[model samples]
Target: MHVVVNAATSADGKLSSRRREQIAISGEKDFARVDRLRADSDAVVVGVGTVLADDPSLTVKDEQLCERRREQGDPEQPARIVVDSTGRTPTDAAIVDDAASTYVCLSEAAPVDRRMDLADRAELVTAGEDRVDLLRAFAALEAAGLERIMVEGGGELIFSLFEAGLVDELRVFVGPTVIGGRDAPTLADGDGFVAEFPTLTLESLERVDDGALLIWRADG
Candidate 1:
């Protein structure tokens, strides 16, 4: 599967404030760009932390884009996938809505009741014992015919993807604003790399609104 990780960060490389709240870092042009990205993907993935913090619908927003997908005999919106180890995704989360197919990747350790609750709203794919095994989950996703995946992330998930060498591309929109806080989330945050950092080759750069878009391909 082709996996792309996309995100918007402030000038200081912060995804959001320490409060973990959603903040608008990109402008209308960038938003439209992201909509196009979503429309082109087979599935859009995110971690549970993002779902809880942003509650994004993860649907294609442009009607023209939806029409184009329909013309190509594709769904109006791409499928949505969430990495929730313990099944903490709220049943009524926007991702679980009928706008698109939703998949919750859970771990075997997730409670049966919680898994049952999510099963009613979304497809459940259980993998790891304590955490959602990304490789296994992605294998299942690929088997289900999702070849192109776009990951709009929370830092933890992004870090994990890179750590597992699953990411194919990294795209970041650096906005003009500055959000400075030590506890703020960065583009990739988990236990950060100490050695043997992931190498990325610059793919492209463009100006979007008041910010810059930098895309890098993962170097093997």
Candidate 2:
């Protein structure tokens, strides 16, 4: 299974401003690019923090992409997967509004009631004890026939995935603007790596509307 990380950040490396809410770092062209990526993947992954902050629909919005997927015998939209360690994703979030199949990945620490509450609306998978073990999450996702996964993240999820060494490809959009607050979220947010930091080989770079798109493959 291939795990791809996709993120758009300011030139200063912040995903959002000091407000820590959903910020538009990508332009319409970037959004269309993301929709194409979503159409190419079997599942789209994100963390609960993204749900709380952005309330994204996580669906492929381009009509042509939808048609292309359908022609290829794929679902019109990729399955929406949320890494909610404690199962706090709201039932009313846009991801759970019946527009697509949704899965809530939880930790064993999540309350039974929370599990039950989400059972009807979305499938639940427990991946770890105190937190969502991303490695196990990958196995479960692959087992469920979602072989290609695209992770659209908040910083914590990005750090967790990179820390686990699970990322195979990374696509980053560097917007021309800057959100430089010290507390602003970046591409990755977590404790520093205990040992060697992972590296990537630049695969491609292209100019987008008012920014640049960089794609990298994890260096072995």
Best by the lDDT measure: 1
In candidate 2, the residue pairs with backbone N, CA or C atoms under 3 Å apart (3 or more residues apart, or in different chains) clash, namely none
lDDT of every model, 2 decimals: 0.96, 0.92
- Ten-residue region with minimum lDDT total, candidate 1: 202-211
Over the stretch 1-220, how does candidate 2's per-residue lDDT look in tens digits? 8889999999999999878887788899999999999999999999999999899999999999999999999988999999999999998899987888999999999999999989988989898999999899889889999999999998899899989888999999999998899899889998858678889999999999889999999874
lDDT of 2 at 199: 95
Root-mean-square deviation (CA) per prediction: 0.6, 0.9
Poorest lDDT segment (10 consecutive residues) of candidate 2: 189-198
Best by TM-score: 1
